[model samples]
Target: EPEVTQTPSHQVTQMGQEVILRCVPISNHLYFYWYRQILGQKVEFLVSFYNNEISEKSEIFDDQFSVERPDGSNFTLKIRSTKLEDSAMYFCASTGLRGLRNSPLHFGNGTRLTVT
Candidate 1:
């Protein structure tokens, strides 16, 4: 089956360094989204992108955050200025437009971002 893949399963950075988390979404899928979970918090939606523009974004996607489809298979999230609060497991998900009763989103294992 097709699956999303994330790189650098774990990353460590200083409080203000920039970091780019990379993901390879499942091919043939259209909708793309990013969500994060702080160590013990609930998963929070960051943003969703489609057709070359943002379809939806939550308050969590502040000015410091940005998403780009740098290439056909690559979806990346860039944090211009990392903060301690940014430490979390970033998950990349993709889904096809079908099954409203089960809008299941396939998620990558996730990239754990650690800021000190």
Candidate 2:
């Protein structure tokens, strides 16, 4: 079974610093997405990328956040300036198919970002 892989399982940074979280989705998958969960909150969708462009994005994906696929296999999320509230567990996910109402998303273990 193919799965998403994320680097640096844990990261600690000071507020106002920049951070880039990297991920490699299942090679054959076509849809990629980034989701996050605050310590005690529900998972929130950040953005979805398909066909080399952003297919959809949540309100949380503001000017401070960006996503890219520098290569065909690697997808990355960058936060320009971290804030205390930005601390969360960020997950990278992918799906092999699209347009199905119930298509499942396979997720990575997540990178725990701690901003102090």
Candidate 3:
């Protein structure tokens, strides 16, 4: 089974800078999602995408955050002017033919962003 792959397992950046996290989701999956977990906290949903458009997003996904599928094989998350609180483990996940609730979701190891 092909799994999601994320780049740069760890990233360190200063506050008020822009960052882009990358992911290559399973080629055959129909749904993709972005989630983030602050250190020692529960995972929070960021955004969901399907058919090349955003399907849902959370309040945390404010103007500073955006998600896109620039190509069929890649999905990305951009955080503009990142703040200290933005530091977290960002994860990329995808599910098979069936929707999320009905199918198993596969997740990448995650990109740990550290904004100082």
CA error at residue 56 for candidate 2, angstroms? 0.8
Task: For model 2, name the residue pairs that clash.
Answer: none
lDDT of 2 by residue, 2-72 (tens): 78999989999999999999999999889999999999999999999989999999999999999999998
Candidates ranked, most accurate by TM-score first? 3, 2, 1
Which lDDT values do the candidates have, in the order given?
A: 0.93, 0.95, 0.93
Error of 2 at 32 (Å): 0.5
RMSD over all Cα atoms, model 3: 1.0
lDDT of 1 at 74: 94
* Tens-digit lDDT string for candidate 1 (60-86): 999999999988999999999999999
lDDT agreement of model 1 with the native = 0.93
lDDT of 3 by residue, 23-106 (tens): 999988989999999999999999999898999999998999988899889999999999999999999999867656889779
Q: Which should have the higher TM-score, number 1 or number 2?
A: 2
Off by over 4 Å in 3: none
Per-candidate TM vs. native? 0.95, 0.95, 0.96
